[model samples]
Target: MEPSVYREKWSALKNAPGNEDALSQLARQIAFSFVDRYYQDGLYRAEYIDLLCEMATSFSDTQFNNKASSALFEIIVEELCDDYEEMPVEIYSRVMSQVISYCRDVPEGVALDRRLTDFGISTFDDLYNRANLVHSRRYTYGAGRPPEKIILLSRVTIGADVAILSVMIQRFMKMFPDAEIVIIGNAKLEGIFGGNPRIQMRRLSYARGGGLFERFSSWHAALDILQTEMPPETEQNVLLVDPDSRISQLGVLPFTHSDNYLFFNSRKCDESAKHSCMAELANSWMHDVFGAGDFCHPTIWVPSGVRLRARRITESLRAAGCRRIIAVNFGFGTNPRKRLSDDFEIELLREILKDPRTVVLLDRGFGRNELLRSASLIADIGNRGFHASVACFEDSQYPRTSHGIIGIECAIGEVAALIAECDEFIGYDSACQHIAAAAQTPTLTIFAGSNNMDFIRRWSACGDTQCKIVHVNTLADPGHVDTDEVIARIMEERSGKAPGAVEPAHKIPEIKPPRRTGKQAKKAVDS
Candidate 1:
């Protein structure tokens, strides 16, 4: 069936009378059609898969009381999995888990274990154990048989790319001086790591906004690239490093032989190092895998033209008598829980503006929502009788306004360059914090939402400069946070009085987990 016809039928059934049997049957049919089209015609429709998953989850037990309905649901699962071998492991797991949860009395012949075995794992625990074993290995490279090419998969997100992959690239350059290093990631990587002659970036796009199964499309492209780079004739002479990349669904999919593949299970490795951040963990993993070497801090090589543009902006700010430039970004990536309330942002801006010589170079973040939020923040701050100027990347000059917020909308590279020029950086637990630390600028990160101490420790910005985190349990109540104390701690870090202080001011008490909204619940299933 065509996509439009299937969508129309699904919508009609959903809106029509309470015929549970009909809805379930139509859902099974659409799912089977999806699997058939994907296998027979190479037409993988993400929307069809999304609809099927939604229907399966939305069905109540009353709908599945009959044997036919239950059998149809089971067929849907088995057919989808059996035909499409390249489906992402995470997506497959999510769908199966949801089905099992709803169908408590699943038939003995469901073949859950058999299906998992097809993906090279007996269970989720087995997957982690295998990853842990890979990370624990301390293999020494043969002195005479270094790989001819090193393929480094991207960590997908900007923050992880900077904190983890950059370190890997730097270490690989030093370890195998003759091997050609190829980076597989998005186009933005060029702006950040393009300047290095030793590293070559191969662009592979991953749809960050696509449906769950849609994300797996990039893996096929990456697989083709790997085949061309590492043919069977020369497989042993090439190395593939997987840094828990989304491209391969965190190394669940096989891209090369086990001997030639190295997966850096970032989440599981270095569990005993409770205080170590991801950058530190990555460095430790490198040392263990390649023997001990000098620790490499995360680094970015901004393009020369981008660097010049950043310098012009900073110089314009300095020419306006702004002695200290502070780069601030409030982007929280895909997780809205990591962000604080608007009042909190306003208060933080107020504190930074207290220094008459400091000028705030605020980033009007990406997407419509973030852009709107940043604009609202600037307006709210201005209502308190503070000077604010809005600027863009195209502007060759900035307003001669000192001790005020200058909101600018620019690219990621521009933000990195500005951070390089800044004396200090401040933001939420987002990419800018990592970028700032990479530039060796003192950074203050106001971490919120999560009380997971280990998570906080693992994600803290790492660099030679001072990187401090102020934990706020905004998940419970943002208003209850001691804004005064938070601001004071930030100022102390700014004054160089608390050098190397990575701990939060006070321990964040454990609170009840927040109930996930409908959209958040869907996102949880998608992830």
Candidate 2:
């Protein structure tokens, strides 16, 4: 053998025993390079991260596979939660995509043993657990193609519900280009979920009267529609997404006549920072559970009429010396954790009043709570010496549905139009923020301190550079936010000021785990 051949053999022997470190370091370098080059916008991050993670999985050996995977994991964790509890959605997608890819290659019935560590937290266990979950589940499509048609069962109820479906539907359309799409949801969704060429909407009739008999009749009608719409059971690859899965709970899942199903119940996701984001959870539940990998952002169809009216309305506001209209929707009834105290809302509005070039447009009519909050807010307007004249309204339906009590598509349409015209939208952890995202407007989403960082990262509207999140941290007393500083940042953000120039009050609070004696680390890793 040549002298070079001997040296190569010796080096391979020397390095093969402990080369994961070098490989990991190289992977880290590559990850940093990727973020540096491609981190221009939110959508860009998603594209590039997807590409890299997909490419990384192709290398199944040590030099590229394990170390690169480990590096990608750490970089993902750092980018997502190093400075804050969550990274942007694109980054989160990249990490999750990498996890799926890794799971794809992991041996069956095997626990992954990468032993990689980021921030002294080894994510091998987490990735392994998630990977195992991904691997073990059986999707109906099996090794063949996806179904010819996807039937999403009827359960559309509110604005947030529409917002969640927007992106997922967009992604599904892209993923299964030729696949027929059918939405059997509330009749109101016809407007909110209209305008897609591929989508065929079947109006779902539900009980409007809040009566047991009416609801019972409505449910029967829905069942009849479902039975009529679904393809034969022998038909291959039909996906039925009963998001919020109440039908399955009612034992009517068999009626849908499709084996592939994804069901979600909204419990155990609030209170602590330990949940996956509401958005991501929705998508991931469908993805991991139902084997649908496509994920997209909320979509809103801005009708020309609505757009024209919004522009005219905004122009009128500008004509009336309303400097920058700051939209506020601080009331959320989904959970108390998402609801801000009236005092906090008032304090922030009072702070905003100090700025002369700014005007606050409160959301007064979305929910019943909002009506009360708005009344209180208007009552407190005198405290800041701002008159009722600042609250601008024409014949616009935007004011009518500001409280969002009745979530009809017409109301959502008007609100979407109005939000599209606003400079900034401020809302709590609810669907209004997602609507702002659909409008491509800048939003300041004040997140409640939920222990599930995954939930926050996935669900919160961060896929756009314009969306900013300030989260509450609770070590023991748990919920504390500097509302005043949040207002200042909101103002600076609205005025197009650089972030670092402003005094920082927003934080991604450190989450303290409940004091349990055993397996805190394991539980955290699992969580």
Candidate 3:
């Protein structure tokens, strides 16, 4: 009979036995029966270890707080070595507690056997399980044939990529209405995909042995979905749209036989000239994910200047009952552990806000408290005349956006809307600045007008070319200026009286003379 069944029968036998010795013998039989059934059947490895540890703990703590019981517990610990490498954290913690309890019971001179003393396998197992739990709860790239393929590309919290996620889901539904899209991410990523039947979601929790493997396992459901919808027999083409920047090399994917192509959905190569090395690598990864040998994939790159919906910022500001708004985008790239000083970007913002007539709306993710300090400095400057307010979304009443779903309370989409409503946008180079430009707001971008300025000028897509489109440098004399210079230029241009646009002293356009290919052309130039 099953050990559980035998144990139950023994429980009844204890009540019906003739004496205490008989009951004790039956109890021993029951314990051995459980070990035999569980171990031999390979049914409850975890349960067996837990039960043995509990028995050893109780025995050491009460009756056998001596050499014999201590030795027995050590034997039990050694026996568990094979499976300890993959044991769950909860189980490991329970077993470790029992081991520690048993160790405490041992007399001062009682030494653990050399074989039992070695904790390398057990400790590694425990740590591995713990790490797995952390990763299990995070975003995963799943495996095998899934019913559908839903890929999330994000460098930080997935919330910042909500615009892309939402668009992808909507597009996926349009392409495959009957199918379900599985979203695999952290606990904080739940509400973002809620109320969508086409979306089946799972949270990866490392706390529950949901580490990297578990994270990968969550994607198994996605693989199941992909397989169902896109079987091998059909030879369906799968395109990987990676916007978060890391692109695998051009080759066969590590797993699966599906003919798939990777697509990078970022504007990395839109500039007229080359970018920095890191920027180039980010673009390269996107292509590599698509199996493109070179970094640039002409056929696959998303045409530059794709339009996103004008998430009306001016309207949101008006609804919030604010007027004469100034959106300060003081976002800078910095590592969390690094201490921040007044960099070039911060210096420019301080000088720009010297005029009291401007209000400041700050993007909070720039550099932690560094951003707050920059805003505070700007606030100090603006206090003399105009009212200044920092834009934040911590209020529970504020509806959750993609960023809020990821616990990054402030939403870039909302900031974009505010910039649309504001009189001017000022900031260092960042995605927030790009979003503002997309919103058609006048923007003052603080880039030193050096060699890189040529690239910046070509890439900038802001509609209003007046006061907002000015660029500055770190070493510019008299710091930076804040005014409606762009507005002035636009008004003058409209009135057909702008000095910059005014015809030069010579009305005729400069034409290139013929190339000096021969002596005649050279002589004409010399004359």
Residue 205 error for model 1, in Å?
A: 2.3
Better of 1 and 3 by lDDT: 1
Better of 1 and 3 by TM-score: 1
Deviation from truth (RMSD, Å), model 1: 12.4
* Candidate 2 per-residue lDDT over residues 1-527, each given as its tens digit: 22233335334534564555654554465567555644554333333344334334444353454454455545653354322322342244345534443443445203222212211214434443432332233343354676678777654455445555664566677667888888876755654555456777777665432222223344445556656666455344666665542222221213332346544433223333244444444554445444646454456664456566666766665765666766677656435666556767777777666666555666665656656667777777665566543233336443221111111122555566667677777888766787776666677788774655655665566323366677654333544656666666655655564343232233322321111112111101000
**Window of ten residues with lowest summed lDDT in model 1:** 518-527
The local distance difference test score of each candidate is: 0.69, 0.51, 0.36
Best by TM-score: 1
lDDT tens digits, residue span 103-199, model 3: 3244421322221233222343443343333222322223435334544433223323332344345444554455455544454434334434455
Best of the two (1, 2) by TM-score: 1
> Which ranking of candidates, highest TM-score first?
1, 2, 3
- Angstrom error of the Cα, residue 26, model 1: value is 18
What clash count goes with each model? 0, 26, 34
Worst window of 10 by summed lDDT in candidate 2: 518-527
Error of 3 at 45 (Å): 50
